[model samples]
Target: MNQGKTKKIVYKTVLHIVLIILSVTMLVPFLWMISSSLKTTQEMFASPPTWIPRYVAWENYTYMLQAAPWMRYFGNTFFISALTIAGQLITCSMAAYAFARLRFKGRNLIFLIYLGTMMIPFQVVMIPQFKIVKILGLVNTHWSLIVPGIFNAFGTFLLRQFFQTIPKELEEAAKIDGCGYPRIFWEIVIKNSKPAIITLVVFTFMNTWNDFQRPLIFLNDDSLWTLSMGLAKFQGTYVTQWNQMMAGALITMVPVLVLYIFAQKYFVQGIVMSGLKE
Candidate 1:
């Protein structure tokens, strides 16, 4: 038993070492960006490429703020992300509950077809989707982003797997107590699926938050632009403002980081449980 415990300790230690190395490898670029954000333009392109800037320019943050309407971009991003999360949670959960629990004609076949949409690349449908949104008069509006993102096939598939994992016994017990479909879904299934819901929330929120392509194509006005678009403004025809852009990039990364920090526990659980086939 002592020898087995020693081997387990060794394996765990080695795993931790590998993870730490990988984490540092991923963090190097972000650290470099932060360091570069604090350096002058001259210092940025200096010989030998200094990882640590000798002189930190705190004014870069102030300068980037003054140069662009970052606060407006932040507002747009926050609003879009919040709404996108709500929409996905509602629509995806409902669709998932139907797929996983409700019985109907061609239910499995319909779900399979619905799930197949995930196999289609976004680029293939981008133009047609834009046209549809255009016909709906949602182009250049935030609705273009929010509405499209809400009813994700992958989100439906994800939550459906989670919803299916729930025991049928619970539903039967609830039905005997005079509960309805909607009531059981709300009180039993949804309440038990908090981890998966949180998982979807974190994912949908992050994807919507960082989404660059949809917003760029859908929005033309600067006032409605997201942080991704605002960051692009740092790149000029001739010169790219590396320092200011990095500062802004750092700022843009904060909310996602905070979100992960909050939802990280459920994040792993959701991923694992959603993959378990019944």
Candidate 2:
């Protein structure tokens, strides 16, 4: 109706076109991987390549399953991810509530010190953690993965920031009603913090599920290996099976893809805190 509105419409149309182009660009590799996995090895390396397979070699998936103990890898990964999620939910939430709501001596300094650990890469701490796990006789056990991953400073920090936004009045009201810290924490804080908790759950689960280095290093047994680790079987020092590798990769990506698809909304909504009012 107006020149300004016309300009806004034109801008949005241009932006949409740009986003569509970017989305297709991003999807090309994924589409190619799907294509390669369906085609035979020769078809994959054919001159000029082909987008569609002459024959959809569904056997590649069957071959992957028979070639490796993928089911065992999936089970092991799920167990590790589940346990890590539970442990992180308990440990991180409690630590976050303490830092955000509870009053104690040296609390701020202690929290700052802990939060600073986020800057330290796992590479720096891996040696000490490995030795600790070894000393505790957890080197080859699932605990080596679960226990070390439970106490993440980033998870604590994320929940702490979310916890701080909650109105102090609600906590005070609960306290005035003779509710104790644990009761208030469970009934009030946690009840109101779903978005943040879900966000943390998604992140922690994804990280623990997709982790390769920890499983590769801490686990010497093939049965305990995760899917990410199992994918290495498709690759060898001397030769690599490109088709099967693509097939294994697509299989490995399924859980992560499923997780994000379902949790995408809560993951985005949790961080914004739009529900909180002044």
Candidate 3:
């Protein structure tokens, strides 16, 4: 027993050391971004890359805000992300329920088709997707982002897997109490899938908020540009403005970081629950 305890302690010490190293590796870039954001333009490229600036140049953030229509970018990003999340939650949940609980013909075949779409690289579909958006007059509109994300095969598959693991008895009990399909789905299935939903919300928010390619292709007007697109322009125009770029980067990351801090518990729970088999 004593030997086993000693071995466990040794293992834990090694694990902690490894984790600390990995954490530092991941944190260094973020630290540099923040540190450089507070440094003068000259200090940003100073030899050895100063980890700390001699003076905290807070005006970099102000300069960035004034340099571009950052407030417009923020509004556009928030609008697009919110719409994407709302649409995905409603559509994916309904589709997942249909796959998980309802009996229908060609269910597995349809699901397989959906899964197959995931295998196809986004590049292959980019041109066709753009053409469709153009034809539909959704180009340069928020709908370009909101509509395409509404039907996510991955989100449907994920929620379906979770929904399938729920006990049939709970659903049957609801049915016996005169609950209809919609009522049972909302109360029994959805309530129990809170963690999974929160996971989807976080994922959808992050992806839509940071997405650049689609927006770049669709939104031509600067006024309609999201934060990601704006940042790309910021970097391209002011390549030497490292401080301003870092400030923009830091500002863009704030919402995601705040969200993760609050929803981290559900994120972990969702990951664990997703792995369970019925």
Q: Could you say which candidate leads in TM-score?
A: 2
Q: How do the residues 1-278 of candidate 2 rate in per-residue lDDT, one tens digit apiece?
A: 69999999999999999999999999999999999999997798788999999989888889888988899999999999999999999999999999999999999999989978877988999999999999999999899999998998878888888999999999999999999999999999999999899988988888898898888889988888899888874475316677877888999999988987889886565455423322
Q: After superposition, how far is residue 75 of candidate 1 from its true place, in Å?
A: 0.8
lDDT of 2: 0.88
lDDT of 1 by residue, 50-106 (tens): 988899898999998888889999999999999999999999999999999999999
lDDT of 3 by residue, 28-70 (tens): 9999899989998888878987887998899999998899999
lDDT of each: 0.88, 0.88, 0.88
Cα misplacement distance, residue 64 of candidate 2 (Å):
0.5
Give me the overall lDDT of model 1.
0.88
Q: How close is candidate 3 to the true structure, as a TM-score?
A: 0.91
Model 3 residue 9 lDDT score = 100
For candidate 2, which ten residues in a row score worst on lDDT? 269-278
Ten contiguous residues with the weakest lDDT in model 3: 269-278
RMSD of 1: 2.7
C-alpha displacement of 160 in model 1, angstroms?
1.2
Total clashing residue pairs per candidate?
Answer: 0, 0, 0
Which ranges of candidate 3 are over 4 A from the true structure?
A: 1-11, 268-278
How do all the candidates rank in terms of TM-score, highest first? Answer: 2, 3, 1
